[model samples]
Target chain A: MKIFELGKAKSPWILHYNTGSCNGCDIELLAVLTPRYDVERFGMLNKGNPKQADILLITGPVTKRCRERLLNLYLQVPEPKVVVAVGTCSCGGGVFRHMYNVENGVERVIPVDVYVPGCAARPQQIIDGVVKALQILREKGRALEVPPHLKKIVRGREGGIDRESLLEDLRRR
Target chain B: MKKIKVNQEICTTIPMGSQHVALPEPVKLVFDTENEVVKRVSFDVSYVHRGIEKSLTTMYDFKKAPYVVGRICGICAIAHSIACTVALERSIGIDGEVPDRVRAVRMIGLELDRLQSHFLINGHLAEVCGYENIFMHLWRCREFILDTADMLFGNRVQYDVVCVGGVNRDIDEKTGTRISEALEEIEESIGFMEEVFTRDKTLVKRLEGLGVVSKDKAFEYGLVGPSARASGVKTDCRIEDDWGMYRDFGLEIITMTEGDALARCLVRVLECFESVRMIREALDSTSPGEEIQLRVRDNPKKDAVCRNEAPRGELFYYIRGTGKKIPGRVKIRTPTFANIPILPHVMIGVRYNDVPPLLMSFDPCLSCTGR
Candidate 1:
């Protein structure tokens, strides 16, 4: 790892993806980044490109048609990533939970490290959720730096958690 | 040594969105360009569809429809809620007229909603033009309005402020005073931004002549809201409808002759100032302590169409109510859906690079379109 990797905990570029949301949560998510809330003070950047992002901030429920594109975006982001599901719908499809076209929530398609709950999550709650995501990313980054044999002893197993199977079970539920 | 096939016109394609920095909502625009001039355009606005209309009719009852409709478009939630409730109220036919206080409160919510939306669009258009400083300043100024909204109502975005018979919330003298002060502050700051937007050489040069839409083309494309008003349509639902308190308030329908991006921006800016004044006027005219709601004796057994001027344009809500608690069918015609037909027409003949700013000028909300 380069010496610059030490700054990973402070500066995490976020990828914001809207997956068929009503836009209530998406606008609130944007609110957290503006000067009023100023989440940028923590060095969090909203990077539209997934490939260059370190954390994925997803708003809205995972609609059937948008699931593939969303998953593709998640896969495009490099590893040592964290996913933060913002809003009630993004967590469990708040008002849009029962619509036929919706897949319920984003967690059904991707593993979520943190879930921020609100009809439209308040900017304060979103900023808190992002702060938590930053901590999780730091842990994931540290896990990547550790030797493979030591990683098992330091954490739990050879690998962290299988997010794909976890996502499948979440969908089944 | 290379052989070229001659005699054919060359056209290239540029796929713009679905998840772009310029557009917060999901929409994909495909532009067919001939040597950097757009020949045609196709839009994919289904990315934000979440079966809201189906849910409105099947899953939720009529009384709950207003709150549900508010979720359809976060930016226009207050407008949707007011329109949905008014439609139901018309169909239900309560014993007496809707209380004057209720109408005034609803109007305040709507005007506030439009205020924030206009501010947001102005900032977003600035951001799309790569003017981050102006975007930040505009949003910073908008925060006062959002804070006032949060103070008067409970939430910022999905304000469950409007209900079936009347509004779910009310404002006190203190909150009203606070809102007035906030509006004064906002107007001062936004006036500075309006000046900057008009006077800034780069912004003016980029937006002045680009994406020109003639009045004839605007009418032909069936444009609605600010997009149409910018082209001198001289049409607005509030002016035409006498059912609401707007007629009593006597608000003017603002229009401009130029149909370019700059004209649209000016329309939104001028409208923001007007909305602030309207809210102030509403505060004075409304009687205090009047009952905000009336008890409905029965469900609406008829069909009614409710139209409101949302931030982007005119939003039409068509509801067919049975004798039951649930509605039979709920059809929504959002402004973006009506405005989207003008997209290809406006984007044509403009450079490929101007597509983003031109599209932002209309401030198309994809959630409204798909829902």
Candidate 2:
């Protein structure tokens, strides 16, 4: 693996966006950053800039106004990123599911990799979800290391390079 | 459109949220500043509006209103549920008939909610002011309060403990003793925090005179909770409203005359002690394993309004029933909604750097405001 991928896997910076949560999961996610949970011990830092974030932690069901902002933030994050939906509201809208203003859940707006389920997810559960997100982040990092079109060329056939297959794959690409 | 002239050469407009690191919820503030001092401010708090009031009247019936309203704001979930349940009970004509044990349990839940919410905002205030160590320490102590709530009510943020007419879960002997033990530890930590907040020169200097709200302005803007009390307004819904047994529990209202950021922080810090005392008194007043919930067969027929003191301020709930399963209307006025109007007033004259801390001092819960 490249040194950049190794460093990215070791430390994942988080960008937290609240679509329209009750402030329960948001605080618990903050609690995970504070002394008791101390997620910083694992080299994870909460970043305010979406451009610098490696993982997007979202809370609340997507509100009509926030839906656009959520998508904008999601698009701004650099690739090899993960999105973790915290709390039941973001998971499937919880109690606010059918509310007129809400879009049901975060998944309706963004692709979520990990869904932490709780009315207001506890700090422990949030930490678990983040840890799961880290694994996905590492897998995504590995996936991005080698381009899909170059796979056949990099891992050639039995004795020599498969130039024909490589050319076909290049043409297809 | 209404237009105003700006001296653009000497002033710059800065927009601070909707999504900010200092704010847990989304709220936007546009500040017009000249020479680092704010000349004016405008705000937008509609980012988190979930139409909870409409849902209460349309989506859910009166019986499920308490749980639905609890989602208005998670930090003050108990306050919303209590106020909603009390209003529902009154509309159903069972206002003062709830058992003493039930009220005690409800008080415990509400006070614990206050303790956690106060800790959260105070720690957040410190963090925004660049005092990260104090923020961590305060939040570290806050875990005890969350654990106690989890032990008593099975969930950390949304307790779902209060229901219509009574409480859903009963506080037994074991949980009561456990709560007492946790409160003792919490009190020790709070004492340490009190010393730090009162004597720490840096924190005091950073917060002392920033965002000063005069007594008249607090009344004029209709500030509630700690923000109003900090300005010597002497208003607390816990005393004015008869929903809880706070009077019997010897609840003392903490007030300060300074009305600055520091005073607001101090008011919340001191109120934590009162919450602790009330929680202890509440546990002592109630016996173990008595009646918890009371059943009611009739739907609400009349309109009733209930008010409760949330950690931030007064939380008001109005419900009108038509003798049907669902209420005809439900209106909720949260504490943050009352407290937010004063922001443009307070932020106008403060330094740009102090904006985040000053805003944090109000403990703005935009979810509550927009919902």
Which candidate comes out best when scored by TM-score? 2
Candidate 2 residue-wise lDDT at B262 = 95
- DockQ, model 2, C-alpha based: 0.77
Model 2 Cα shift for residue B151 (angstroms): 1.0
* lDDT string, candidate 1, A1-173, tens digits: 54546667778888999987778778777777888888889888898899989889898888787899999999999988999998888999888888999999988999999999888888889888988988888788777785553443445534455566546545776
Cα lDDT for residue B27, candidate 1: 86
Across residues B122-186, which tens digit of lDDT does each residue of candidate 1 receive?
88888889898888888888888888888888878877888877777678888888878888898
TM-score of chain B of each: 0.95, 0.97
Q: Where does model 2 sit among the CAPRI classes?
A: medium
- The segments of candidate 2 whose C-alpha lies over 4 angstroms from its true place after superposition are A147-173, B1-9
What TM-score should be assigned to candidate 2?
Answer: 0.94
Clashes of 1: 1
